[model samples]
Target: MWEQIRANKRNSILLLALMATVLALLGWFIGRAFSPDPAAGLFGIVIALFVWMILAMVSFAGGDAIFLAASKATPVTKDVHPQLFNVVEEMAIAAQLPMPKIYIINDPAPNAFATGRNPQKASVAITAGLLGRLNRDELQGVIAHEMSHILHRDILFVTVAGVMLGAIVLISEIFLRGMFFSSMSRRYSSRSRSSGGGQAQAIMLVVAIIAAILAPIMATLLYFALSRKREYLADAGAARLTRYPEGLASALEKLSQNTTPLSVANKVTAPMYIVNPLQKKGMKLSDLTSTHPPISERVRVLRGMAGASFADYSEAFRKTTKHSTPIPSSALKDEAVQIRSAGSQKSADSKKQIRDIGDIMQKTAGFHFVNCSCGLKMKVPPNYKAHQVKCPRCGKISAV
Candidate 1:
């Protein structure tokens, strides 16, 4: 997780540089198009930086709220929706996480999301359809998936990405307005036109206008790519926690098959839901550049891990994963309540749920001895006490 954070930090810095450069270039292109002032390019970069900082602060404090409000989700109580509350609570305990605040959207879509500045302040919201449709275990799997995200501390980047979408758009609009005051468009130099070289300036102004139009579209695509990556990570995390990948796999199938889109879904909040808010219409993966991984792709990975034990999941993750830090037993420690928040704030009757999940853990015996995705299985004695157990069949060691 620390490595993911460091990488994210690096990525954020690089993206900021890229955004600033893009904005500056557009500004320069525009300035050259018009009366040709070299200073205007610098002005665009400065404006973009100022807005990025302000947007970052807003995202830290209020971004989640804006998304929730946009989606018309209301904070939920146990009494209002016990199924959701129960499912979330049980999953939180299973994942060893604090109870995140619960919310329910009135919409009939089966989707959910986790958000907050940090885990302690985190909130998870679900749609009414999610409760009404999925069965207990499947719902548990779905919520567990969201809970995994909280544990991973992956919220800020997502929320910040969402905020940047809006900021870039606002910046784009401001660029367009610059045309009204420019004097380069006049044939005969209107009283307001400051044309030193009239017709050539008009062409530059036109090109600048086109760049303003295209800027938001490009930024939206970048945000889309981040969401896809985060979804993959979250899916993998869920499989690791439940040790039953099919739970989430089945849930994704249901979500993908369902055709009821969330009524309150807007461009801004589209990335918050488990599935795209627009999924009911069966859009192509190419059309989806938001919060969800391709449902098909996510399901494929989870089903592959269904028979996998925690150790099995970790090794696969480790192989292609750049970050080699072990999944601290602490991170996977009971109920995800500690070992940090796990810092996953969840939703419910904490003690009872935690105890129940612990009992389940103890009774749900037999971990993957090989813990490999290569279709190898090895069973150990019930009382096996090795720090690492190597699978005799595949010779893979699942460590203590």
Candidate 2:
């Protein structure tokens, strides 16, 4: 685990440096396109540095808040959903990390994700549908997976990479638009024609055009590669934490079988989800552009685990993918933990579970729950203004 963390840190630094270099080159090319002076490249580097710093600060400070808001997730308490809270708490204890703030998205898509700058500041958010659909063990599996992400510092790494990738996209967009609309192109063209540096100017122009077109794509591919690897690591972590690879394997099956796409997930936040929330119908050309490894393949690897250990998962991954080591050699423990099934503790009452989840979501959304004398529970929305409401079950008036 320690080795994995160190490798991730190194990879993150490399990714950032690569992104920075791309940004600097793009800026330099644009500067050269606009002016003949060599000092223009340095000025462009300054602008790139400024943009990176500002965006990095914003992403570190407020990116999680922005993500939660964009997903329409409401803060949830243990009092609102004891089961979900208990699962998250159990995982946090197993991982030996601080409990993350919990949130619930109202959407029915079975998806969940964790985000924050560090473990101390981390948070976990799941859709109400996930709570309703998954059994206790399955929910624990999902939470454990997320907790692994927090423990491994994947959240911070991914967050920073995402911000840098966005920066690259923004810079590329501006350079492309400027090239199309600004007088810089015409000025450069006239200067190249009049001066002896025509070939050099034309070469720079081609490089700038190529950079503008490919920089974002390169950044995206790097981000996706990192995202996929972290997911496999997290899965291994969850299996070891819970001592039950089947729990997560089954959960993945359930998630993949569901056809509904998450309405709140966009390209920016899609990689954070446990399963790819975006629905795809047919064969994908390559996994290079995907935010996650194929769900079927992940499930196969998990199902193949003979015992709950990093070594076990590593072997499974090798067999399933026929390439690349999933677990670092230093991180693999010799003694394997046996899988403990939680089937006996899993609830079988689907309707009751659904009702419980609905009640919790309503409470999280600030709705008032009223239990009537007729043995009926009614929820009043925040927008409701009536002081007295009649119970729909028994036609008895109740004062708010």
Candidate 3:
């Protein structure tokens, strides 16, 4: 996981550097297009660049915090919502980590997110509607999935991307608003800058101007794709950590079927949630360039993991969730991942390892409901069975 974080950091730096270069080149071209002399144009280029860098950094940092606040999420304690609190606690212990702080947004939108630079500092937030709507198991499923992200170190990308990507898009819009005027300004100011490579510089200037025009658009697209892919990665990681894939599956199903999108879910932080908070009910993830995998695909891959070996499930999930080429059986079968050296094997206990829903239902006596394909858990209830009789999640007719 540390290695993955390091690698992700490298990818982020490379992307940022790439963006900076394009912006610098645009400044250079803008100056050359207007300058009377090479030296003066270069000076203009440097000043323009200095301004862009300072603003970009501020915008990136400020945007992330502002977006989080805008989502109307407030940090909560065990007293706020004990059920969700306990669920996160159990998952934290299972993952062998400190408990994450919890937040609840007062919205009917069914979505949740984990954020912070690292696990030690992370916080998980869910919508009020999700709590009111889902039953015990389904809610655990969602918390488990979010905990998976906290365990896997995926929050860095989730948070940083929320900020920088937003800033870039905003920058693009600001740029576009000025582009036409700027282009005309360039034309009127085009008298001086002809130098040794006059024609060459002219063509380069045109290319740079066009690139400046498209850079934000490209950056927006890149951010969306990368953001969305990370969600799939987190999904697969969550599935790996919790072998009870059905939990997350049900959560996603419930979330997807709902239409109440969060009003606070703007472009910046929308991608961090378990499901896209954009309110689109029927659209698949592939149909849009948003930050989440389609709810349908997420649920599908988790359910498919039901009885498969961990190796088999991981490969299948990567293929299906991320739409990547199938991994070879030989590669996935590497015992290094699942099995360890002599006397040091990590037990396959990484899984929730529980298959009997009845056992779980029996343990949690609060408001229990159970359903069976064989129509057993759901039978005619006694007269007093009406109160705590049936399983609400499955809509099963209850007798127990």
Task: Point to the candidate with the largest TM-score.
Answer: 2
lDDT of 3 at 263: 87
lDDT of each residue in 52-121, candidate 2, tens digit only: 8899999889999988999999997676778899989899899889989999999777899999999999
Off by over 4 Å in 2: 183-197, 283-286, 345-361, 371-375, 383-400
Per-prediction RMSD in angstroms? 17.1, 3.0, 11.2
CA lDDT scores, all candidates in order: 0.65, 0.84, 0.60
lDDT of 2: 0.84
Model 1 misplaced stretches (Cα beyond 4 Å): 27-35, 177-195, 198-203, 287-291, 306-400
Model 2 error, position 199 (Å): 3.6
Span of 10 residues, lowest total lDDT, candidate 2: 279-288
- Candidate with the greatest lDDT versus the true structure: 2
Per-candidate TM equals 0.70, 0.90, 0.68
Clashing pairs in 3: 369-391
Which structure is stronger by lDDT: 1 or 3? 1
Which lDDT value does model 1 have at 67? 74
lDDT of 3 at 395: 57
Candidates sorted on TM-score, descending: 2, 1, 3
